[model samples]
Target chain A: MTRLITILIATTLLAACSTQPTEPDTTLYNRLGGQAGITTIVDNLLFEIGGNETLIGFFADTDIDRFREKLIEQLCEVSDGPCEYTGDSMAQVHADMDIDNRHFDALVTDLITAMTEAGVPTGAQNDLLARLVPMHDEVIHAEEHLNGDER
Target chain B: MPDRKTRLVTLMLTGLLAGPAFGASKILATSGAGSIEGAAGGGLVPWAVIGGYGSDGEWGAAASLGRVDVDDFRLGTASVLAGVHDRLEVSFAQQTLQVEPLDAVIEQHVYGVKTRVAGHLIYGRLPQLSFGLQHKVNQNPAIATDVLGANSASGTDTYIAASKLYLHALFERDLLLNGTLRYTDANQTGLLGFGNSGGEDPQLVGEASVGLFLNPNWAIGAEYRQKPDRLDAVDEDAWRDVFVAWFPNKRVSVVGAYADLGSIALWDDQQGWYLSVQITN
Candidate 1:
């Protein structure tokens, strides 16, 4: 029993030490190829969305250039880059968009396709998606307040 | 001869394959394949993630059939599982174990339920955590009592599991890690039945899995599951497996593994191949 405890402790310590990255290369922004790469990804994503029939309707009334700028800034900031996002909050921007799960999923799929086309590595794509996932709640139900519905 | 159990499994598979898709969708390969015990995981060990593609406020169901061929034994399993809002899961499985030379067949039924308590696998810092309970009953009690000297023909196992997916974990690949602690008195996962005649207590064991996602749809991993040593008649050892899982689409998945199930029913060094197929909606 004592031997088992000792082994468990040793294993835990080893796992902890192995996963922690040093200060030199811990930020996800650097791994994503910094601001230039992010701009390319965002540009490709907007272009793909613009061509997608199902998603194009959502952006018809919006300013494509301004939206692109805001998205780039948001991605850069969220990935721990030096840029700061000065756009409206996610809830505020999407509050009246009435985006459902299907629309949200379509946009994400387009984004992933764009990233792939931009030569973004799979790991970096997943990391960026992970950071964006937490904003799902704020983005998906922006119209629920007017409908007084709870999901 | 086709039995009632076989017919039920067939019907369940048909239903699962024919069911309409509904609910919020999770990313492909995020919901792992069903374990032999009817929980969502690898071929052998269950992970903390719920089964199927259902996100919050959605419903999903999955069914799988598996076969494991060992040196001296052959095991077949069929299971069906349902997930509610990606928070609670209920599952049922039937296992048939055939012993070589003796040509004896032992059958068991397992019913399981799991609930997600907290956390998310990818979105947050906290690892996904869940609690599960499984009740198992042997169809042939005589074999368990007379041949194996087991105390009971049925038992319950409870477990807590934590799972996490780390993007860019090493060399720019996604890594998935899981840890499980189980409290069980079952002998050979209840194939030999539950408890022991030696008046020993239930054991607490650990299980773990580590996987590398080569892509969004493919994962390669290894799992280790610790078992209890309750029955005095035969020595039981831990189980380990190396597996590859592929998700061609949201509705179909296949997992293949090489398993080392050391010592079962006096048959030592039971190594073999495992295969499973699943359909989900």
Candidate 2:
């Protein structure tokens, strides 16, 4: 029993270490065609998302203008630019909203649309989304918590 | 390093794959208009194929089995559904409500028709709205006092009007919201006693659900389902649930959910877990 437990603990630690997140790449900035490209993608994405009646319910009380500006600033910062994002953490902002997977997926759809509209090309869109994919782990936690505790 | 270029190539390939994932497809919740994947008890949700034909000419089908246990009574539902011509769907179900010594079973068969109303730019940029209607022909009334040594109960006839609004790019992935209004005037649906007949008004139930695909075959959804209590005696609480489904391929999908079953017999407003699996070809 002791040997089995030790092996299990060691395996768990190895798995966790193997999946460690790497630092955001600086090359993404150049690949995204700098600030202008990020701005265009955000603009197109917001249009598609805001126009959706079901999805718009999530941002019903949000200030679209302010939200749009924040997105641009945040995207610019993440792409290795000089800007700093002062917005709330993704988890904290969406925590109390009962934002389920549907909402999250909808936002993802909007993001993809924005990329398409901006002519970022499929290759670049996929690259950007790969970086954003990890955020889904933090942003989508309600169901995880609910199911995690279920006996 | 070579590793860096390889990573970049991998990222580009993933991005290319994501576009096809967002193609034209409506995201219907696990329980929007069909079975709650795998939950016990039975109401309106159909259990069968995904209700639409895919890009291929062949149709698909799905099945779900679920059970609800409260006090000494248990209610279970097993259903199968199939799609044809990318528009029509037909399903059949057998539901059993067991009360220890006595058992009551209701059988339901459904036929549905749907067609895209328009795909033009409606008031700017709405991709398209599909209109559909479904009729449920039910049978096997096991509640007749003369036959089962129990009180008489009436049967029901129901019709569902459904609409699917397909929008690409409201979210990072394309999204679809499906809304349905159900009207049922069956004599036995509410379990009213003998000679009661149809004294109550028709049930006006409304359902709204949103579905988004993380990928073509994987979707996450949430739905709000509300059905008023037409009968004065029974207090039928409005029901709601959240579900996630995995459609591994075109013909098969599985669903699991946290469901609120309202009230039945003397169950404490049944709230618990549900699971359903469907197969289509």
lDDT of 1 by residue, A11-91 (tens): 445444544343566677876678888888998998888787657887878988899999999999999999999998777
lDDT of 2 by residue, A109-140 (tens): 57866776676644455556655655655566
Score each candidate by Cα lDDT.
Answer: 0.81, 0.48
Candidate 2 chain B, run of 10 with poorest lDDT? B36-45
lDDT of 2 by residue, B108-173 (tens): 333444443433111113333444444434445444333422223433334333333333233334
What value does the lDDT take at residue B17 in candidate 1? 76
Q: Please tell me how candidate 1 rates in CAPRI terms.
A: incorrect
**How would you class the docking of model 2?**
incorrect
- Candidate 1: how close is chain B to the reference, as a TM-score? 0.97
Q: Over the stretch B1-281, how does candidate 1's per-residue lDDT look in tens digits?
A: 34688678778788877877875366677778978898998878888988987866677888888999989999898898888877898999999898886888889999999888998676557999999998999998787788778889898999999999887675456789999999998888999988888643578999999877766777777788999977878989999877778888888899987788988978898888899998898
- What's the true lDDT of residue B218 in model 1? 76
Q: How many backbone clashes does candidate 2 have?
A: 29
Residue B135, model 2, lDDT: 45
TM-score for each of the candidates? 0.81, 0.48
